[model samples]
Target: MDIEMKKYLTLLLSGMSLIGCASSDDLSLKQNILPLQTEVCCESASHFPWFRLQQNQDLDFELNASSPVNQFDGSKSYFSAFTFAQQSGLVEIRLRSLMLDGEVAIPQVELLDSEFNVVKTIDDAFTVKFSDAFAKNRYELTEKVDTVKTPYMIVYVKTSELGKKVVVPHPAKIRAQESGEPMPIVTDPTYLASNNGHFSLSVETITLSGYNQKSLVEAKPEEVAVVQKPAQPAIQAIPETQSYYHNAIRQAVESNNIDKALSLLDEAKALNIEGAQEVFVRAVNAK
Candidate 1:
């Protein structure tokens, strides 16, 4: 083959290889956290679903869970999770209860084994010492003896009876992020486990929604073309911006203030401030 033909063929093959690599990368398998959907786990009638999240990286969580379907007699059992990373030494959490129920009954937090046996009870830290209103602040739990070797964790919580059945708004938040070391954030111990366990044990196996993270991929295209008008440019001190007529016209045009600009042009025309035709054009296009 001629040197010229060989060179052209080599360039074409290289280009094809690059394109193939790009297409493969785009289609490669990559796991990612999807958009979170929080559902409640209830007893007797219904219960909130257990959510699963990988340890480490952060995902935006919305704690806006639905209220109990049956307020007369309703109890919930939910299991939220975080996978243990190799370097995961501590699990940090920020637990808060919603005020929909009108009152607050602190829930129980337990670290369970693969078989769902309680390894140890993790305390839900409260801000105030002696009060029903427990502040949802940061809490950290570190492995005292050695690292928790549970391959599968069942971070469990069951709803309580507050003397009377009080309906709550959103489900209580049970956030646990893997921390290699202790964070510098300060925490207050408001409630202790040996302090307050659940009113009763878990009644039965209630299956709620499982946390299935939606992958973060290319955004879906919109059907309609969205034309976002740019912000109104600040009025300058130049001739176009200085004159009351010009300023009013520009503001109107930029901010869809066409009527006001027309009114200003009418007033300017009445005043006869020179060149009626040029003034109208300049006022209309107040760049």
Candidate 2:
């Protein structure tokens, strides 16, 4: 072959090899994609089938077109119901949804009593987090529930979250960046808001003993009577007493007299002292 023809063929073969590598990478990603749900809608909340949640065990499920649609706050969306098999003291529940395949599920929770009455509603609690092991992003929410009052919970998508998108670094691009590749292909793939995706829920029982003992103390009848005594007349602070009030609050907090420090704070406010609130907060936080 002539020298010019040989040079042209070499360049053409190199270009084809690059194109083949890119195609292979795209196919590999599609092949390893996680499977999504294809079921129908669940029943209404009152008669909905609830999956039993066991302590310290993780349960995974999906919400799709088959998931039940319910009206909440005047908007319709899909939901899932769950009930604890056994609970005691305070239980911590952790919920997470995977952001995969350009879709994500934004979840809110409603805690219900035995009569199916709403006890507590939780929203805007899920925060985006990354998982290195799975090379994927997830939205996670961790909340403590009092099992005595609320034993049932429902996971649902809020109306406000619909059409919202979560921007995440593409896993393949992240790998390229981490490998120190020059001119690495970088893309911020967005996961669209959806009521369909994979999620996992886990529960852990918390011991009451871990709480502060002072907060659990109840006042006796005699103590209540003592507290009901007439209050002393308020002593107004003189003008230009800002420094005095600040020092007094710091001293009280240093002595572990939180009540006295708060009383000083109220007195300072009554005197229209500017920056008194900031000083009081700083003192308390320092303690």
Identify the leading candidate in terms of lDDT.
Answer: 2
Which residue pairs in model 2 clash with each other? 40-66, 41-66, 42-68
Q: Can you tell me which runs of candidate 2 are displaced by over 4 Å?
A: 1-44, 170-185, 207-287
Off by over 4 Å in 1: 1-76, 92-94, 98-105, 123-147, 150-158, 163-287
Please give, for residues 19-54, the per-residue lDDT of candidate 2 as tens digits.
455653353233222111112232345554455554
Cα lDDT tens digits, model 1, 71-188, are: 2113332233333333333444433332222223344445544343446565444332222334222222323211143322333333332223332121121112233443434342
lDDT of 1 at 126: 36
After TM-score superposition, the amount by which residue 15's alpha carbon in candidate 2 deviates from its true location, in angstroms, is 39
Candidate 2 local distance difference test against the native: 0.59
RMSD of candidate 1 to the truth, in angstroms, is: 27.8
RMSD of each: 27.8, 26.8
